[model samples]
Target: MHPDQSPLRARSAPRHVPPLLLDIDQMLDEFSRQAVRAEFRFDPDTPAVVTVEFLAERGPGVIWRIGRQLLHRGLTEMSGFSDVRMWPTLSGERPSSWLLLETQEMEALFELPTAELAEWLDATYRIIPDETELDGLDWDGFLLGLTGGPGVPGE
Candidate 1:
């Protein structure tokens, strides 16, 4: 019996698994391919309804819409992919917190409460092995100085 194929050994053995790092480019690709959808709240107080659609082909990389208005057009690529950061609050939290999406040029702040961010991530990205792999990363300091805190940009 091959050691690698041995059932007993496989059951008891633990393989050295590499940490799952967030690859923004790949994530965007998956996001486009899957046609993922999520709500972007520009204003937390008023609960502004903003729609985010990831596009694989056709027009700009993303479509931002509020009611019948189009805010941005022709976003070829997410500039400064390495600099985006996300900060999610504890599960089952009220009114939801925020997921800080920051870039060198601008930031997209969303009020994603509790499992909303997690659900969005699961829907948009192809997680390897399992979703739990994502828990290893530090979302609070995802991009360091680019962000202010977990809930919002300033607070």
Candidate 2:
């Protein structure tokens, strides 16, 4: 088991949304879906990032770190670009959201319950509000780490 899949890790996360795997059969023109286990983690120390781990049955889980803002905005409308995209969807009986994760090898689509995700996102905001994400960041230390003792980028 991967360290990120430990019980303690899941218990420590602020929110964990149960995800559904949408199986799209384009050749047959049919759509089938089932529940899948995935963990969503938010760290107050990195207020702007959200971590998602897709658990596997016999191996380590797949992890992706997404921007919290992008997920929040996606609840209402389409957002994201390139490898990640999310948009609102009203299908079946529930108003859910569609998350598209693309890589060079393949792409996967998951259906997320909008209400639950929105509520979870709201809780994150209460912990660290928007626009104040950088309130406590140490700029000098960050720059120094980036440039290896920096006064300027090239100097």
Candidate 3:
């Protein structure tokens, strides 16, 4: 779907792409495997970040904030480092991407449909193009917030 035609874009609100159902790679534990549902949320107000929420049967679940550009780059090639990493896999019958999320306690791997993710990223770009990401930022307010009020010591 064209980004402009998206209902969320029309309303100028955060866009929540439909839940992407993925299967947790059984390689983590040969005996235990299950489906994991995730939702991708993009806010035009915070154009640089994309929030990924892993849904659970109960409670708040898990949330990860990732750089928007990192994900876009991952769609075609391997991207990210440290705790998060993603890469496209053409070996499968259906083109998909492998996303790895690692923490001190454990690591999880998920296969995502490449085309669907690309489409959603396109929509986010349409809402707020990369070049204009800082256009709406409040620089003065941001500085004040960062410095705990008033002018910088040097100035």
Candidate 4:
């Protein structure tokens, strides 16, 4: 091994946290109750819309979909959770058009219109059809953090 590339140096190197990242733990908790829908498009100029849905509690991880395209199968160990990256554009600090969902073996990137689209991904248990529904959810499954807020970036 090169002397300059010491094992200690490599271990000490910091991972690059993006300028904005929606909390991953929050997202996981949010999905545990119900499926949330989001929209994305491959191209900016074109008007094609793809609907993405988030599902949870299947196993150790979550699931995602784009329209009728079922991303993965049922009861599978492999799952990918999404990270909403907030990009600083000329307009302001808004959620980036792209999202990265990754797992051990693979990663999928998606394009959405704006950062606001990530509002549905919050872990607050914000979407309750009725107050009674809350009684059945597993509140203990959440591993929340102090960062990130629903519908806002870098909160």
Q: Name the candidate that leads on TM-score.
A: 3
Alpha carbon deviation, residue 108, candidate 3 (Å)? 1.7
lDDT preference between candidates 3 and 4, better one: 3
What is the per-residue lDDT of model 1 for residues 1-155, given as tens digits with 9 covering 90 to 100? Answer: 67568777656523322221221222333234222334343322212223444344455555443421111110111222233323433545353443335556765554333344334333322322232434556656766535655555456
Clashes (backbone N, CA, C under 3 Å), per candidate, total 1, 0, 0, 1
**lDDT, candidate 1, at 38:** 49
Using all chains and alpha carbons, the TM-scores for the candidates as numbered come to 0.26, 0.71, 0.72, 0.24
Q: TM-score of the candidate numbered 4? A: 0.24
All candidates: CA RMSD (Å): 16.7, 9.3, 6.3, 21.1
Q: Could you tell me which 10 consecutive residues in candidate 3 have the lowest summed lDDT?
A: 18-27
Rank candidates, TM-score, best first.
3, 2, 1, 4
Residue by residue across 1-155, what tens digits does model 3's lDDT show? 67559776566744444444443342356566567777788877788888888888789879998888888888889999999998887776877777888999989887777777788888888778888977989899788878878765545
Candidate 4 lDDT, tens digit per residue, 29-63?
42342223342222111111123443334533343
lDDT of 4: 0.33
**Tens-digit per-residue lDDT, 53-134, candidate 2:** 8777679978999899989999889999999888888666877788888899978888777777788778788768888877
Best by lDDT: 3
Which residue pairs show collisions in model 2? none
lDDT minimum window of 10 residues, candidate 2: 20-29
Off by over 4 Å in 2: 1-30, 143-155
Evaluated at residue 66, the lDDT of candidate 3 is 84
